[model samples]
Target chain A: MKRLLLFVPSLLLAAFAFGQKAYLEDPDNFDPTQPTKILVDIKQCDCQRLLGAPEVFLWTWEPAELPASDPNNNGSWTSSNPALAMTNEGDDVWSFTFTPTDFYGVGADAVYSTGFSFLVKAKDGSGLGGGGCDEDKTENLSIKPELPEVPVLVVAGFPSNLLPQDVFTLVYDNSQEEKVSMQNLSADEVYCYASAFVDSVEYEVTPFFQVPNNAALQMQSSGDGTFTLMFIPEQFFTNVPTGSTITSMRFVVRKKVYLGTADQVDDPLLVPVGCP
Target chain B: MKITLKYFFILLMAAPLFTACVEDDTPDIGEEGSKLDGINATWRLVEVNQQDDVSFTLETRNISDFLLADGNAPQITFNSADKTYSVDAKGKLNFWGTEGSWTFDDDVAPTNITLSPTGESDILVNLTATIRPVDKFLQIEFSRDCGGTSIITYLYKYERAN
Candidate 1:
């Protein structure tokens, strides 16, 4: 009888560990004091009751407890307020944007020290599954506080997260270039050698040397030592076979005319492609 | 005397036939006002409702105050005489472009209006009512379809501005 009790608890723990996951939209720039969007994937959660709910709300009690003075927190497990509702991001993923300091009515120091602990759930979380405690809710999720830091050179534009068919822009800041040879490069002479891994096989989409037909691969100057290249992967990589999945892409920026090895700017950037 | 009585009964029966044939009062097609007449004026967006078609739930949000505060609300004008429409979005939320020509699927009681924006393909927009002037309201619903299934719908409600 004692062994049966021990086995049941262990099974529940295993299920909870493998359930839902959460990701920050901009993890590299995560700052507790600034507004940030957090995405939660509830595809594997035991919340069958929330599958097609018109709205979902965040229920949090960790990092710092919800203050009674906070207007958005209604302080009821059975009824969640609409002010804390999350935006549906399709495909069972939901996102909530909030600044830690203002959301919890707490100081930045407390937020940085404690981080976040929360769960996605329906407004009315009654009679949901897992013996009522787990119904219409995702497993407890947490995010450790990390100070925001400026990236060395490249940063993604618009949708920081990318899908294969989406139009993505890679912004290159010449001022932040770390390599001594690539620093202070002129924006007007910038070009990119683009390639993609289709179904795990590498295929060059643009030639390393400037060609008449590869003019589209040239990065456009956005002024102030910044350059950007925006293209749709499915459209830009014409060599990729149709119906084949693009797993990731690689880019190496350089001058139009390569002068030995010093003309290449920065290291090759490899970006993983996300599922549609 | 018998022949005179029989003629009186026949005349009484014929009186009912004359009443039925007295020219029906129903108006002809062109004589009645066209549906375009009600939709010819300017309209200002007041509210937007997003509906989850799969869930069959609607979430309504009033944006009239927001638009007023921003001072850039989208206003659309329809010209019934020329079958043309113009939108003054002022760089705001607008589905239709700056100018377009509109036509109804059925002129008498149109359920949809096909808007052909300048240099753009035709877009069929569903109408909530056969826009009449007395209604003082216009509601248009459109859906975003993914893989042949409509995932969500947006209902834009507008009030007659001019």
Candidate 2:
């Protein structure tokens, strides 16, 4: 009677376990056109067979259409999506990083209506999708360019270098002024200031120029996004004696320009003013 | 969500793990007295080499003695970024005087720097000082051809300010 009582409870427990169906936790909305989409998810409903399983394996296919029917076999898998299989991360969550090309991007011109899909199985031979009933899809479809590259600021023309003369003669109209233009410069955020070296101290020569609202900047009509700053030193000296020779000078575009030469992008050209 | 809990537990375990590994091994990128940054600082006269009528040799004296103990500290502040250099010179070093524009020769590497008066006060002459940036200081060699072989070579040693 004691043995029968234990056996009856075991039979009832076995009957209750057979009703739990295995299924994949699929993403509700998935677009197949993003350049790069990475996901880490996927849990099995009935994972009792995979108990203590060290890792799980995933079979993925990309740039390929969804299979017509549910696949119950494992031999029909390819590694087109860069990853042939993925081990379970934890909590049944898996990792999937799609190739930038597999998605239907605007630049691709080729439409891949159906994105990549993959099936999962435990390394211990346990079926992932409802015990082999469904497949999982990724999210996001972007038709845009792969990704924008970082912009680089290019400085051209002058921090107009070269010391032409010893005395900075205020020619009736021509004073030694440097014209420095920047390419691909976003002037809205980057404020430019002119810097000159007199003795050993670096003075903000930006005030000497007739700039836009005390901001030394003037954008050119070159559609290529170029900005220029004219640094003319009329009252270039402050509290100094007369007939002072101007030494080297350069232009910098950044916030808090005087926070020292560090963390600032300065034009490489130097104005070597000559003594006439 | 299960994911949030997993990451939270992971962050908990990782919090202490990473705390012990927190060590900033970044290289010191301070470029003191190199390139243009070399001359960008207040130059205080620290040492001097007084030139006599003898050979190219001159008398050596710290700035304390060169200024005749006058406490009227003679200093040529090269605020180069503003294109202005102020000078409060006294005694034999009367030429620097007040303010001026200090320039350096660039055709070659900048070893020659010229100090020209900026304000109405005209400098006796356009003083061109030779600059040599040592590891932590800028050594300016100013020479005046008083007459013939009686050239005065004033070696002005300057220490950099922060």
Candidate 3:
């Protein structure tokens, strides 16, 4: 019996580490004939999953900044209806569906493409009160573009389910031959800050920029550049429940823009939320 | 055989007493100044090396025009005993006249210690001090923000207040 108990925990850990199912599909070859759509499916057997996952996910649009009404409706396909409740689909497959909106936004036309990703978790039975799950856990799905594709930029990695609270480290690498500039947007949450690579440089602005919560380091590209940005929680949103452990984090890096211009409003690119 | 077994049982039961006595006799093995717990105490930001040979005061109040415009001062607190410190986590450590968190990298007894700001890559202050029994004074070199060393040096002295 004692051996069985140990076995159960080991199995549970293995399951947690490799427990969830996640994938993204965008029809094949940018199919111009059909509306460009990015589809996502994630599910977990664990019971204590986080509730009220963020629905609105945004990413940097090409050409950097865009008008308030995105000129090119990058063929969005995600529905903004509502988060669906988990159903017992056979042997415990708690699932959800995601449809990505057009790149140009609500309406417009173009190849409408930019690189982005997602953060997800296995549903443990905490908030639901099933009592048979672990709630404080997180996972991520990082998507990158290969050669011939435009550079895959990293925005901000923040917590979506502001439960217990969270800390994150974002690594920015400027391996490209050309120099690149970066910025962060914490979605108007003060105290959310980003600390760019260690101490080589410092970038501070009045009214913290909307990049990541902890972004302070800035630099012109040194050859083959790499930077690690860290995100530490200084406080929480009003909606977050007290005593709830942060399960995961989410945020975006609006597209990078030249600092010399007055037109700096750019589309923030999305990435899977991460927890460190 | 039964007597021998009884004696074995008694010895086994008394083993803990012997071990306890031995442990009591052992001395705490630690180096001269390597003990963090002994040196643990509250430290305030005494002074910092700033531009134009100016010695910047470390206040836990919002005093900057920009910070006041934004509302708040750059305040820093150092509690070495607890191994924790606080800086403006909003990526605005510079507004408080410093960068990131403060680190007590190494503590050398008799007068030398290395401290650096948290989240910074370059070295900030390499302090050489005169460690008196009660009055400790140190000469500090500050790093320039715009790619050069501070022409002037800032000195700070502390007494065992706590």
Candidate 4:
């Protein structure tokens, strides 16, 4: 019995050191807060089972206690936000990217992830799984895990903004995970923006900001990972010169960490406005 | 106090009864509704049936050719007071409604209608139409016998744009 206990700890310690879904290969390239992409190359599970693409659920929480804290394992390991779901990129490789703002709801005085964990459930939920060690760290908290592999950010929803006459609407591909798009736009009274799926994370993104154009924005969550965005165009561009037309106006999701300190999440939603 | 309570109870009991008694005695429109009530409202093209085989009794010259062009579905709004119709495409009224007059013909299934432009009297000869009114739609057939060689028929369907 004593030998088995000692052997288990050794095995767990090894898993902790080498077990990571994937790491941010280049966290310095783009805004880390945005729905950034990370090419997560998944390594073989300790279980030695032939791995397939699994539905990854990210569990982020403020460190408070150990396994003894949430003994029932109800709230701690619960699956609520599908925003962290991952996509399998064939050849035993997978991709997981999203705006942490969409998942973590922390603000200026917010607590960063004292600990974050990924629960890779089989796409079938067929009683098979892979996560942290089966040790007492259940109550332990971590800001980041030291898994062997590194993961990048993945995003969803590519929009084609084809607004006809009076009615304006956007369509996106919905056959993916926690997909988010920022392409819904409208032209009404003031320069407004309709950003969708905003998170209360510090240094995150707002719907729209003053970028030369007289722009304002509003957002409402819509069906199947979609957001309806309405925007106002610059008055000058509104009635552009006969031959001139406005195009490729971008709005991103970012949060304000401080007065001059803020960052964006994931990718930006591109739209076209102005000139008839 | 007792009287107030009794009146309050009576008012509550009578409220629903009075509400149910309210009725829309303003008369009901026909199952298909009236087409002339909105004679001046904007009408938009929804469907067209252009057949090149019919009688050439009234001069016909392919109106579908002018309509169903590249972009923007065509629409026409008639000004009852001025007796002039305005045609708009892509929100701009610069296409075809050049001071035209319209009159309703007496009928049932296929309502016979006439469209005559003031200056172009020749167009008035071929613009007379027998329209089928179906639930906010006016389906008109522009047919010509082609003087015996071949008959051409073009069906243009329009709906309320507003």
DockQ of each: 0.01, 0.01, 0.01, 0.01
- Model 2 misplacement above 4 A: A1-276, B1-34, B56-63, B66-72, B90-92, B119-135, B147-150
Clashes per candidate (backbone, < 3 Å) = 2, 45, 56, 56
Tell me the deviation in Å of residue B145 in model 4.
33
lDDT of 4 at A223: 50
lDDT ranking of the models:
1, 2, 4, 3
lDDT of 3 by residue, B1-162 (tens): 999999999999999988877646557755444424333443323343222221211201111222223444334444555454444433432322353334445544423333345554634454455333233323434433323423223233222334
Instruction: Please give the lDDT score at residue B79 for candidate 2.
Output: 64
Give fnat (model 1): 0.00
- Model 1 misplacement above 4 A: A1-147, A155-158, A210-213, B1-162
lDDT of 2 by residue, B1-162 (tens): 999999999999889887788898889966443334456566666666544322211323233342444555566666656656776555335446587776665623575666677655433221234333443566766544433332344566666743
lDDT of 4 by residue, B93-120 (tens): 1223355776655423325456676666
What's the TM for chain B in candidate 2? Answer: 0.57
B109-140 in candidate 1: lDDT tens per residue? 88998999999987778998668755687888
Model 1: DockQ score: 0.01
Candidate 4 vs. truth: CA RMSD? 23.5
Candidates in order, TM-scores: namely 0.37, 0.26, 0.20, 0.24
lDDT of 1 by residue, A1-276 (tens): 999999999999867654547767777887667898988877755545567777889988765676657775745767887788899999878899988778887665566667788888877776544454457777678877575453555533323334565445666777777778777777667778889997669989766765324788777776887877876677778898888988888888877778756877556887777632
lDDT of 3 by residue, A89-202 (tens): 333233333222333232111223333343333222133332333432223343332213334553333222111222333434434212233333222311222222112332
Candidate 2 lDDT tens digits, A19-93? 322211222322333424333344333323443445545443433433434331233432222233554557645
Model 3 lDDT, residue A100, Cα: 28
